[model samples]
Target: MTVASLEYNGKPVVAEELTPEAFKKFGYVISPKDQAPKIPEGTYGMAYRLSDASIPVNNYGNSEFKTEAPCAFNLQRFKPPKALDRENKVYNLPNVERHPYTTQTFFPMGVDAEKAAYLVVVCENDENKLPDLSTLRVFVARGNQSVTYGAAVWHGGTCSLIDQLDMTMFMYDNGVKADEVHLVETSGLRIEYHL
Candidate 1:
C-alpha cells in the first residue's frame, strides 16, 4: 500500500465530496433525513441535535461537566484565501485543532445558493496520540448540511470556496478562549487542497 503525505507546494490533494459514511471517523453528518424533526400534524419544522452528554469526560474532570450554562452558539464568517484570487488552485493548510472534551458543530448559512460549497480537512490520531498525517482527508461540504466533530478529533478551521461564507457554530464553552489544542507543532505537517 502507498502512504500519503500532507505537504504541498503546487500539486495538492483533491477534496472529495462529503458523505455520512466517509466522515464517520471524524463525526456525525447532519442531514435532513437523519435530523428530521418530531412534530404533530399541524406543525412544520425540522431539528438537528448537534451534541449531547454522551461525550466522555476525560481530561476536564467531572466538575467540568456540571456547569449549568447552555452551549455557546455563534456565527462565523470565512473568507476565501488570497491564493485563489491569483491562481484558482489550492488553499494552504497551516494548522489543525481539536476539542478534547466536547463535540463541536457548524451549520452553514447565508451562502450564495449558486456557490455554497466549503472545505473540511480532518485526520485521525496515531498510536502516539498525535495526528496521523498520512490519514489526512479533505471534503467538500454543501450549504444544506451541518457537521458535528467528535470529541478530540483533529480538524482544520472552516474554509470557503467562494468569496464569503457564513456559518452558525455550536459548542460547549464559555465562548472566550475557544477550548482547543493546535496540532501543528505536534504533527509537524502542513497540507493543501485542490480547488
Candidate 2:
C-alpha cells in the first residue's frame, strides 16, 4: 500500500496528464461531454451535483458544484484487513443485510459498457489529510490536492473530506448484485485505525 499527502493553501489542483492510449489494455474511454475526457474502464465516477441548492449554476463548464442532501458524507478509506476464503471452501453466505437505498447520487458508467470504470476524488474542505490504501495506485493531481483513479481499478468505499469537490470520474466494466456478501474468516481480518 502506498500513501501520499496533499496539502492545500487556496491553490487549484491541476489534473495530471493521463492519456487513454496509456491504459488501453485496461479499457479506457473518453466521455464526449468532458473537455478533458479520459475515462477508465470499471471505475467510479466522482462529481459534485450541479443542481444543488447551496451552489447552483446554469453552465456546466464554469458552474460551481453544490453540496446538499441526498449526498454521502464522512466516509473513510476502504482497506481490507485480510483476504477472503477460496471459492470451494465457502459454503453458506456471510451475514448479508440490506441497507436502505440511499438517496445519495453517485456517478455510474454503463456497467455493461465494453469499457467501464469508477473513480473517487480526494477533496477535503478542512485540510484533512488523505488516507492510504494497500496496493492501490492513485494518480494524484500536480499539487497533491486531489486525485482521480482509472477504470476497474480495485478500490474501497467513500472517504472524501469536503462536501463539494469538482472532479470528473468514470465507471467501467461488468457489475454484480448477489443475494449474499461473503467473507471467510482469517487471522488478520480486521484493521485498526487511530482517530
Top model number, TM-score: 1
Worst 10 residues of 1 by lDDT: 1-10
Alpha-carbon lDDT, every model: 0.63, 0.24
On residues 1-195, what C-alpha lDDT tens digit does candidate 1 reach at each position?
A: 112334434335567767677888788776553445655676556433545412322333433444443577788888875533325546567666777766788888865433436777888887965667677888877777678888778887787776777888887653223343434532233334443
Which of the numbered candidates is closest to the native, going by highest lDDT? 1
Q: Give per-model TM-scores.
A: 0.69, 0.22
Give the worst 10-residue stretch by lDDT in candidate 2.
Answer: 90-99
User: Considering only N, C-alpha and C atoms within 3 Å, which residue pairs clash in candidate 1?
Assistant: none
